[model samples]
Target: MKVTRYTKADAEQWDAFVRASKNGTFLLQRAYMDYHSDRFADHSLIFHDDKGHPVALLPANERDGVLQSHGGLTYGGIICDESMTTPRMLEVFDVLLEHLRTNGLNRLLYKTIPYIYHLNPAEEDRYALFRADARLYRRDVLSVICQDRRLPFQKRRARKVSQAQKLGLVIEASEDLEAFWAILEANLAAVHGVRPVHSVEEMRLLNSRFPDQIRLHVCKENGGIVAGVVVFNATRVAHVQYISSSERGREIGALDLLFATLIERDYADQAYFDFGISNEQEGKVMNVGLIEQKEGFGARAVTHDYYELSVV
Candidate 1:
């Protein structure tokens, strides 16, 4: 087997591998990667057999001596073909690590996907063999609303949705993202204790690159902004990319109302509603409960594979 850097010609194969793999994430999509490639200081690598058919893929972002498996990618690591035998996976990993070390990388972080929502068993086992020490991170709880709509509710979520509607909440989809970004950034710092993932330029670029895929859903009340959500309809799944609101939003159930409206309109036809992940490291308890709130709406939790590798 041989390992090499990815090229423009490999786009179709790369995406095909992702679509076929059980552990694939939206981040591995060609369009998503290309949309944010300019922000990262690295590239992607693929492993192939003598037949030259692609078998495994690793998209990493490198900076200085620290090498990460696609930093820009929410989930990263060696996503391999499920049919690959353990021996083949080990061999592929060996070559991949050797390449990284020889290239002056001090450490290799797999950023092992913690959720296996759809990973093939063989690919998951490959990750198991290489992981050294595992660090438990925040969980990205998912809900299959369409599959089991009668989920147990801890609070009156559905009723709240109705109340939000009664409270004169208006949901609008528009291209005016600058207003949303301002609210998002401020909310991120205040609530999550972090910065927004995308800059103004990056968001604009992505918005232009994926117009149909990206959408800004805002919930207004009393003729002003109360809450807003950035929803991405990448495939069959409708993911809540980002959500934010002001002080008044909490009082009037603006957020709950906004999400309810967005889900009804944007994700109404889809089967899955990805509420995004909660960062436990950031002391985000309210958000953690919010994930559970989604579960109340008949959402299920999906876990991914998280792996770590040491030089052998």
Candidate 2:
């Protein structure tokens, strides 16, 4: 395979290839990746087969001589199609490392696309990572619900949902960013002491670009937003990208009601529903209370891993 450095001229082909990739999500698309291009030194690459047909794409960025695939996204690696066999993956890695070394990059940080996101069996990169002697640096666990064979929601969560229902909250899909972001920002500041990854303007722009893929669902009380979640919809998974609740919302279990509506009514048809990550500090610590709340909704664990590879 011939490895080619990505260029703006390659955007069309790059996006087409990602659409056809086994594990590709809209997050891997140029439309999504380029939204914050100004913040990252993009070092993405495209691989062409012997006949000059594209085989894979690496969505990556370079920082301080280390290449992350990619620092901007939650998870990314070699985005390949069904043609990616184990031996072929090894060849790709060999070429990838050589390309990195030749380009003066000494280390590569690879973030894996979790299995639940795969359109087909796509674990060849894992086997190849073992061959390359990559080190596991981080592992974040996401709470996921398998739709068809879902486990029953814990009684505790059920009770909360019931309580929330008694409050007469309205749950609906919305385009209201101001109300939701206000609640989200305040909640994050008070509880986590951090801010949302995307600014209100940035999120609005993204929503406009991919309205169907990115959605906002709000739980409101008397036309005022109390709790909300931003869900990123993919072929097999509907991932909760952001979630927050106001003090009033929490007291009445507003989030529980919102999630119950999503899991049972809104996204019941999806194969998996991902409740983002619970681990912090580069996966060293688990937030027990947060994860237990997700588990109460019958969501189980799915790990997203990061590997460090020596390219020198």
Q: What is the TM-score of each candidate against the true structure?
A: 0.79, 0.98
Q: What lDDT does each candidate get?
A: 0.69, 0.92
What tens digits encode model 2's per-residue C-alpha lDDT throughout 1-312? 889899999999998888888999999999999999999999998888899898888999999999999888988898999988888888889889989999999999999999999999998999999999999999999999999989998999999899889988999999999889999898889887999999999999999989999999999999988899999998799999999988898888999999999999999999999999998998899999999999999999999999999885
Candidate 1's displacement at residue 83, Å, is 5.1
Clashing pairs in 2: none
RMSD of 1: 3.6
Model 2 / residue 252 / CA error / Å: 1.1
Relative to the true structure, candidate 1 reaches a TM of 0.79
Model 1 Cα lDDT, one tens digit per residue, 46-68:
89899988888888877767667
Best by lDDT: 2
